[model samples]
Structure formats: structure tokens, C-alpha cells
Target: MAEVKSMFRDILSKQLPVEDITTMVLRKPKLLPLKSLTLEKLKKMHQAVQETTHQQEMVEKEQQQITH
Candidate 1:
């Protein structure tokens, strides 16, 4: 009975491994001090272009409905 208990304990230890998990290195993100003027201007231009395209699509849809 004692030998049987020792064998069971050995099996349990083998099935369940014991070890410390590796931890990831912590890092801090770099902060930007200011935004670029050129980039801001480009973003505004892109938004204007998108609005113009949307307006044109709406106009085309209106004309199609009238013709049909």
C-alpha cells in the first residue's frame, strides 16, 4: 500500500510540471510634443476631397432616379 501511494505521487508530479513562467519586459511609449503643420494641412485636404466625391455621387443618384 505504501509503495502504491509513492508511485501515484510520482505520476501526479510528472503529469503536472512545476516551473516559473517567463515575464514580458515592460515598456513606456514615447510621447509626441507637437503635430506637424504639413500633415495637418494634408489631412484637411483629404477630408475636402472625400466630401466632394460624396456630393457628386448623391447628385448622380438623384439624376438617375429622375431619368428612370
Candidate 2:
């Protein structure tokens, strides 16, 4: 419980859109073993998500430029 709440708070603090956070928590509950993860692990996961999102945005931008 406490760990789960802490992970939730950490995710919220990242300033992700509420819909995205909700989807992340609800859509893939099995993917995140929040109860078993350490604080360090949670931070790493957050960083990875951010990096992946950035990469996705860059890819979309490149695709748009190519099409234009």
C-alpha cells in the first residue's frame, strides 16, 4: 500500500496528463509490479517512460516532415 501510493505520487509528480496516468495504471496493471519495486526502480521506470515518449514524438515529427 504505502509503496503503491508512493509510486503513484511519483508518477503524478512527473506532470503527465491525468488521462495518460489513468490509462497507464489501469490498462497495464500486470506490467508494473509496483508493490515489488524499490524507489530506485520506480524512478528508473519513470525515466524510461519519459525517454520513450520523447523518442516517439521525435519519430512523429520526422515522419510529418517527410510527408510534408
Candidate 3:
């Protein structure tokens, strides 16, 4: 479906690794619903993922600095 393709495109554009996306979609069947997803909602989801990843990286860096 077009909505599914669009969702895949949005996920890819977020720079998520293909393996992770594949695993996530497989594990969470509810991720792709029958209803159409809005662009705004996709963008928000991407932004949230980016922010969470950034925060995680920062925390890891801080931990490494402390160890070194």
C-alpha cells in the first residue's frame, strides 16, 4: 500500500539502519496500520527518534569520558 511505502520512506529518511527497521517492523506488527498516516505525524515521529538517539549518544559519550 501507498501508506506503507510512505512510512518506510519516512523511516529510511531518518537514517535508521535497515536491519533495525526490519527487526522493529517484524516485532511490532502494529507499527504499520491500515489507516493512512499523515506527513505531520511521520515528521513528529522522526524528530522524536532523532532526539532520543542524540540524548543516548550524549550519555554514552559522557560515560566514556568519565571512564577515560
Which should have the higher lDDT, number 1 or number 2?
Answer: 1
Q: Write the per-residue lDDT of candidate 3 for residues 1-68, one digit (tens) a residue.
A: 99999999998798966787676333644566655668768988999999999999999999999999
Q: Residue 56 in candidate 3 has what lDDT?
A: 100
lDDT (0-100) at residue 12 of candidate 3?
74
Clashing pairs in 2: none
Taking all chains together, each candidate's TM-score versus the true structure is: 0.50, 0.45, 0.46
State in Å the error of residue 64, model 1: 0.3
What lDDT would each prediction earn against the true structure? 0.88, 0.85, 0.86
Report the lDDT of model 2 for residue 10: 97
* Model 1 residue 6 CA deviation in Å: 87
Mark the 10 consecutive residues where model 3 has the least summed lDDT: 24-33
Tell me the tens digit of each residue's lDDT in model 1 across 1-68: 99999999999877734443355667998888586889899999999999999999999999999999
- Per-residue accuracy of model 2 over 1-68 as CA lDDT, tens digit each: 99999999998788866786566333644576546558778889999999999999999999999999
User: So what's the TM-score on candidate 3?
Assistant: 0.46
Question: Of 1 and 2, which scores higher on TM-score?
Answer: 1
